[model samples]
Target: MNERATLITNEIVEAIRGVLRKNNVTFGEYRAGFMHLVKTQQAGEIPLLTDVFFNSTIVDIENESRKGTRADLQGPYFVPDAPVITDGQIAVEDEHKDKPVMVLRGKVTDLEGNPVAGAEIDIWHSTPDGRYSGIEKHGNMDKKFYRGRVMTSEDGSYEARSITPVPYQIPNKGPTGHLLENIMGGHSWRPAHVHYWVKAPGLRDVINQAYFEGDEWIGNDSCNGGLDEMVIPEVIENGERIMEVDFKLEPAVAKSLQAAE
Candidate 1:
C-alpha cells in the first residue's frame, strides 16, 4: 500500500486494538473482518446504507420516466379534509387572484393502468402571494380554503380545487434552503407545483409535486430533476386556466395488513 493508505490502515488497526484492549467481551480473530465490514458499511453512501438496513429501496428515488427524483421540500402549507368536487369544477378559495382558477382532475391507477379505487389524495400549495400559512402571522388570508383531500371512487378518480400554483422562492430561513441559497448561488427557487401525497392499500405511498409547464423556473427546480411529465401544461377553456394530471403507482405484491393484524 502507498504511504497514506498504510498510515490509514495502521490507524484503523490501532483503533480496533484499543477497542479490544478495553472491552470485557471477547471477539474471535475471524470476527475482525466482520468489524471492518460494519465500519465500511456505516461509512458508505446513503443509498447503500438505507438499502442494507431497511431492505427497502427507499433511496432508489425515480421520477415518472425512471429518472432520479429531485428533492422538493415544501413546508407546512397543507390542510386536511377539504371538499371533494366533481370533474371540470373549479377548486380554489372563494377570494380571487389575478391568475385564473385551475381545475385539477385525474384517476389514480396502478402499474397495469387499472383504476385503483379508494386511493387517498392529499393536495396543498402556497397562496398566490407566495407565502404559506403557519409562516404568515396576522394575515386575513382564507384559512384552509385552498387545501384538501379526497378518495378515489371505484374508477380511481379524484379531484381537487386549487388556484394555479405560483413559482415561489424557498424560505431562506430553513436549513435546507439556507444551505442551498448560500452554496448554489441563486437557484434555490422551486417551480410552480401542487404537492400531493397519494396512498393506496396495495401500492407504495407516493409523495409527489406536479409542476406547471411554461414556468420560468421549471428548468431550475431544486427538486424532482425538472421532469417534463410532472409538468402539466396550462389548459384554457372559455377563458379559464385548467390543469389535469394523472398518477400511476406500482402495485404492492403483498398489501400490508399490519393494521388489522
Candidate 2:
C-alpha cells in the first residue's frame, strides 16, 4: 500500500503537531477547533483557511531590478476576451455618475524604452460600491460591466476612463471573517486598485494591479502580500483623478527545439 504517500502524510501531520505543541495547544483544543470549522462549513460559511489556500496559489511576479513596473496578483475575477473599446471607458452607467471619475493614460514599451504598438491591455476592477461585475451580488450574466479591453496606438500609448477605485473588504462574513477579526485579529481589506492584463507580441505577458496612493488600507492590503511597488501616483485634473504610468516588458524566451541527446 502506497507507503511513500503514507510516510509523507505522517510527516505533514507531525509538522502540524510540532506547531501546535509550540503554541501550547493540546489535541483536545485542536479537535474542538476542527469541529467548529466543520460546523461552520456545514452552514455554508466560507472559512479563512479557504482564502489562505486560494491566495497561496496566486503567484507574484517579482521585479528583481526594481525597474519599470512589477506584476501583481491577477485575481480570480478576470474574464478573457472582454469587449474591446478605443475610449477605454469602463464606468459609464448612470449609477456610477456620482463616483469620482478617473483618467488612466500609459505607454507600453520594451526594455529599451521603445513603444510597443498594438499591445492589448485587459482592465477590470471593483465598482465604486465595492462590488465586482459578473459576481453573484452584481448578477451580470451576459453583459460585461466595469471590464473592458483597449489596444495601444501606433506609438504604444493608451488611455482609459474609469471611476476611481475604492478600498474594499474581502468576503468577511463567514469563518474567514471570524478568523480575521477574532483569531488572527487582522483585517480583510484590499487597497483601492485596478487590474491590468497586458499582452504584446515577442514580449512576456504582464498581469498587474495599480493601487491608489492614499488608500487607508494601502499599508494593510490583505491579498496583495505587501507589494508597495504596485502603488501609483495620483493627480487631479479638471475634477477628475488622473494616473499616468508606463509599462516595460521583457523579451520572451523562445521554446527550445533541440532533442535530448
133-220: candidate 2 lDDT, tens digit per residue: 7766466743367788889999999998888878888777777677777778987888888889988998877788888888888777
**After superposition, which runs of candidate 2 have C-alpha atoms over 4 Å from their true positions?**
1-15, 36-68, 141-143, 253-261
Candidate 1 residue lDDT tens string, 1-261: 478789979997998788877774455743864664565445543332232233222223323232222323333455555555445243454565456667778888877788889887777777786765433541645544456666888998876555676887654444344335664465456677777777788576666677787888877755423446678877787775666767777644343543332
- Each model's lDDT comes to 0.60, 0.76
Error of 2 at 195 (Å): 0.7
C-alpha lDDT (0 to 100) for residue 15 of candidate 2: 95
Please give each candidate's TM-score: 0.60, 0.82
lDDT of 1: 0.60
